[model samples]
Target: MRVSVVINPKAGSVNPGLIEEKIRSALFRCDLVFSKAKTLEEMDQFLCEELAHKTDFFLICGGDGTVNTCLQYLVRAEEDLTKIPPIAVVRSGTANDLAHEIGISRRIDQAVRNILEGSVRNIDIIQISSGDKKAFMLTNGGLGIPAMTADLANQVRFSLQKVANCPQTAGFFKSIAKNSYQLIKKIGPGVYSLMVAEALRTWDPNGWELEFELPGDKKFATNAPIVLVNNQPSIGNKFLPAPFTSNTDGTVNLLLAEGRRVREHLSSFLHLRNGTVSQSDRFTSYEITEFKVRSKNPSRPITFFGDGEILFKDVAELSVKCLHKGLPVVVGSPAWEK
Candidate 1:
């Protein structure tokens, strides 16, 4: 009983031979394998040498930055502690939202026959930082203005956010207008926080100056621009924002838009097409494990991202926590979410 599949096959409508012909017809004896990461340093050496522990399971298709690059080598080998494995997914690229919140299967032979009829679950990960150079170990990280629209939707890789369901205006305003001239030839000073969050429409955007601390000592600013630091629930599940974010919740919710509930998340676009965007106010909501992101206008630092990819800027500080280091997901028994 062995299984290993990490085929990205350049994602986006991937067809690595139709996920190797339906995981070779739903593993009649299992032991099927595939790994074609194609650089994130060869998927960090096929996820730390032969899919770490020669695959008991490791299936992933792309998007959510290749599931945060295979959870940054399985969460830094458990923060350099090691010995951890269990992950499965297939919802190929373009905002699958952790495979629709760990349910997997946008249909690759029914997510590989529910991983040849599965068993396993323990999910929750989100750790980013600026102190020791760890910026994105994600399930979607964040910073104000949807962390600069996930760094302008990772510089235009086939715009219109590869097919958006409004994922923050097609993944952050069409990745800052289809990669603003190749991100101004590579981060030439975050094009002034991408032109002050596009002429102050607000992503907590307008005119720099940042300072934040939460999880208990609550202090803040994005110069009174509404806020949003969520880890997942689809930033474009029509802005479900942090709608009770939980993968087993260690905690990192914080959705503050403040005062008049930041005018109900800046008039939350009249509840975008019915996803209900949790109708902003009471400065959103807050739950935490750790936090801090500072900016006193040190040239518009205040940058960080994961699901959208950025990572950093002139930023002086950044941190997020909650790492119950989990993986190994597949749950479908009500005759499969019928």
Candidate 2:
């Protein structure tokens, strides 16, 4: 089988020499083509060639953001679904959420073996639209608390990455980040609450006034402090916000939370990590095939984030729906188990 391996050279703390060694050792008999995508334009170019040639397996060696960026290109391609190859993700990012969900191994050799032995599973992708703009997400997205924490994390990541380019600070910064990366990945929800508290001091603490419309003409309005929509069960590889969700189930889960106070936010986040947020009166959960979210105040536009990145900035409305089995992914085991 021909495997097109795309690696994000700057993703997490991946050792390029070690990764190539493992790939060569594990995939000795396969026709392999490797590409390093350091920019979006480079990623697009490699993806175009891979799709045109119809590589059997497109292995993504990166973190969640890298995987999401690849999906953005795949979804926007002009070719049909058949032209797109089944994807395999390796745990090369700090928060390899999707890889963790699908039981992809963090070890390069094991992940390569999983790709060899894994089965192809068609999974749902969330299609998000705001006016004429459109984006696709495989895991989760949100406004309020989710977006705030993600924005903060991205900023920190960007700053550290920028400094890592400097020869003087590279070793020190990388060492700190590498040591703390796994620790923070495990205790993400608590860290997220702290980040949210900091954000509240600078952002609009009152939260957004928005309306949600589901199928059957059901409508509700909320001034909730957080609104998370998830195609998969987990967020950030730590919190199980939708424990029962299956990415292949042809529906997305919605979670609305009310936590205006810092203490309340902390409490809600604790429940979120424990997978009991929906049981509390402070939160409401729904499983729907599609929905529409609009800000009650057009003057105050709310930004939407998907898969840990900004999807639409300063947008008053969003339309989101599940495209059932929209993409084929190679999973080590059933995706919902983790």
Candidate 3:
């Protein structure tokens, strides 16, 4: 097999030396072309120039962002999907959301073994376009509270990193802290009320206007405080905002929280993990193949984030469509095989 390996040495606080050793041992009997990319630009260049053609497979050793970056560039490099190589991800980042959803192992040895022995499965990719920019999302994307929380979490992460002096360690603790806080806030006594009060006091409920077309071409409009479009089940590590979501299903799940007041917003926030928010009168959920979103006022731009990174901001309009079974990925256990 002609395999191309891309490793992000800075991912998930993994020891670069140890990962390198594992990679060497795993591919000892195969033809290997390896490169380490510490930044997105390097990964882009490598995909466009070196790994664009004639590669049988791509082994990505990093987290969601690293994997997203490689896939984005690969999709851009070859307009022909058949020319792109099947990818296997080694879960080496904080919040390996995509890896976990696809049943990829976090342990390096097991992941390597899976890469060598696994079967390929076709997976769906969310193609997003905003004005002149285009990108692809492998996990979840959202505006409103989801975007707010992401921005807040990044600030907290960077602040903690400044004190810890290690990005991986900071991220580890950040995940723990963020998850714990969310759990407590959701289940603690009076915490739900406190959250609602705080949200009412601080949050701008109708920051944007959302217009979407359902699967049957039915048009709907709403003033949503938050709109989350999911291709996977979870958001952060533990938040299963859309439990029914599947990346290979040729559809995306949209969760719209239509709560404008304290009581309505509180209900939406409280039911986020259980996905019962969809049952709420103020919430709307849909499984659709394509949709469009835009800010209410063109001058007042909004940001939508996906796969733990900001995809686009300061754009008046955006659109997302699922390219059903558009990318081939190697998995330890194929869901369809069952």
Candidate 4:
């Protein structure tokens, strides 16, 4: 069999030497082509050349961002979706949200083994559009709090890199900080409540006005501080914002917070894990096939993000639709066996 392996050396706690050794040992008989690039531009070039070769599968060793980037290029290169090779992922990222959802192992050897034994599953993809820009999302997409937090996280990472003068050291410190935060949040839900309280000190509740239409032409409008559209159940690692969300359900789960005060918002957020936030008077949740969102004030565009990456900035309007069975992925048996 012929395989194309795309590895992101900087993803999470990845040890390239160990990963490469495992790959070489496991697929010793298969014809393999390995590609690694530091920048997106370089990755594009490498993908263009490597994808043109007739290959059986793509083994992607990286985080969700790297997987998303590769998928973007693949979509652009292949005119026919069926012609694209099935993709298997190794969880080499901080969150690995999608990877975890698909039951991919974080261990390097086990992940590779699963790739060799996994079955192809058709998963939904979200098509997002704003003006002339369009992209696909595999996990989750949102505006408001998610976008805000992603921006803040990026800024923090950049500042750390600039001050530390070493990207690896910066990433190490960032991982430690994030792990600590996650540990605290896991230990007690009150940690998130405290965070929400602190965030409300500067958070503007009237940041965006949203109007959405459900499957049956049921329309609703709201001025919300945060809006999250989830295709997968988990966000940020362990937080289950939409516990019942299913990627193959042919619908997207929407979590909209209409709270205007810190206490109200905090109360709503605290119910995320229990999936009772939707029942709150201050929050609205919907299962819709498609939706359209525009800033209340068109002059002031809202920032939007998906899968922990910024997708649009200063965007006046955008639409999102669930693309049913859009992606062919190789998932571990644990995911499908159930």
Candidate 5:
């Protein structure tokens, strides 16, 4: 079998040496090519070369951002879904939401083993658009709090890199941040919790007056401080905004919550951390094929993010739809319950 591994060297705490060592131990008698993608141009070049080679499978070693980067290329590369090789994700990034949802192991050897001996599953991809700009979301998308926290987290990461001039020191700081994120995730808060707290200091209740167009042309307009569109279960790492979400179900999961008041938002946060947010009265949930959201007050534009990366900013309206069984992916033994 031929395999091409696309690696994001700056992802999470794992280094390339460890990943290569594990792959060598686990995979034998197979043609392998490894490519390091530290920038968009490099990743695109690698993909173009490997696609010509007709790689049988792509093993992506990074977080959700890296996976999304690869997916963007693939979505535009092929018109026929069957022509694309199945993708296998390895957990080697800060927020491995895709890996966790599909039951990919964090251990390098086990992850490679799963890629070699795993079942292929079809998963949905979210097609997001605003005006003429279009993109694909592999896991989740959100406005309000999710968008706010993603921006803040990115600023913090950038600040750290700027201050730490030495690459070694920057990597060390990244490891510390990643470890801190994981520790918080286990305690049920997730990394978003800390950033959310900081966000509340500048919180504006009137900022998110928006209108939602659900399936069947049903319109619901309200003031919601958080809105999430999910193709998978959790956001960040463990904050289960849509606990029963299914990526292959031909529909996307949506959640809207009013996190304006301190006490009300606090309760909502607790429910999110516990995976009970869907059942809470303060939140509204739906299963739909497509939806449109726009800022009711046109003066206050909205920004949305997907897979922990910002998609569009200062937009009056955005639309998202589910592309059922859009991508073929390899899953581990303990793959998500479908």
Candidate 6:
């Protein structure tokens, strides 16, 4: 098998040289022509041209952004889309949400072993569209409240010396609370209210606004405040937003936070970090193949964040859909195999 390894050197302090060594060690024992994509642009071109003409296995190593970026290229390049190579992940990123759900380890030998011993599983991909000619993977998407929080989290870090001794996510949360006063002063009370989607009204008991249309059944709108689209079952490795979802589902789970209180957000935030938010009252789940999202205004400021970074925004319309069992992924289980 010919394997292409796409790696990002900076997915939370990954040692690029060590990764190369690990993968090379594996290939030494196989009849594989090894290729590597060092940057996003190269990964994109490789997926589009190199991948389109050949049939082989490919590997991705890095954070969520790195994985999403590579998927975007493949999704765009292949029109038939059904026939493509299965990808193996190295879990070289901060969250490695995709890797965790699939049980890929970061320790080089273990991850390589998993890939070598694994079977191919078909996985789903999200297509986030804008006014431009291209679209990217929408593995996760959120706006309004948590969206603002993600942005604020980065700012808080940069403002305070742009560095930290031990900047764990918990510390980031503390910074959020400490700067909550400042955020309210600057972003206003609407900031938190946005999490509840102030404009949306949920059933007093059921929690979510349940008004969004489920694919093919536009007869009525369901109510849900925050409609989160999930590709994999977990994020940050453990949060099972939709534990039942697998790569072959041909659909992504849509989760909605149905409550109308910011105070509720406090607990939910922890759920998001700890990987259990899917069952909380502030959240609900659904499955969809395609959907559309509209902003309050056409010319307002907005940002769609995925896996802790902003991808794109500043538009009023969004066309989102799952490519439907588009890509094959590498998966292996070790501890239980014994």
**What C-alpha lDDT values do all the predictions have?**
0.60, 0.80, 0.73, 0.74, 0.80, 0.60
Tens-digit lDDT track of model 6 for 174-245: 566546534433442233334333322321323222234457656334333345667766544434566676
Give TM per candidate: 0.32, 0.89, 0.82, 0.86, 0.90, 0.72
Residue 338, candidate 2: alpha-carbon lDDT: 34
Off by over 4 Å in 4: 166-199, 215-217, 335-338
lDDT of 5: 0.80
Off by over 4 Å in 3: 158-202, 213-217, 334-338
lDDT of 3 by residue, 188-208 (tens): 223323333444556675445
Where is model 2 more than 4 Å wrong at Cα?
A: 164-194, 200-203, 333-338
Clashing residue pairs found in predicted model 4: none
Clashing pairs in 3: none
Instruction: Write the residue-wise lDDT of candidate 2 on 1-338 in tens digits.
Output: 99999888877666866887899898999999999877899889998998888788888898777889999999889446655789988777756778877788767887887777778888898999999999988888898767887788767656655554556766777677655554554453345545665666655655468898999999998888778999888876567889999999999999988766777777777787788876789989999999999988877677888877788888888999998888888888543233
Check candidate 2 and list the clashing pairs: none
Best by the TM-score measure:
5
lDDT of 4 by residue, 1-338 (tens): 88788899766666777788898887888888887778899888877776677688888888777788888888768877787888888877644678888888766777777667778888888888887788878897688765676655545444544445545566777677666544442333233233444456667765457666666677777878778889998765546778888999888888887777777666766666566665677767788888888776775577877776777888878888998877888888663331
Error (Å) of candidate 6 at residue 8 is 1.1
Model 2 TM-score relative to the real fold: 0.89
Off by over 4 Å in 5: 166-190, 334-338
Indicate the residue-level lDDT of 314 in model 3: 74
Error of 1 at 251 (Å): 11
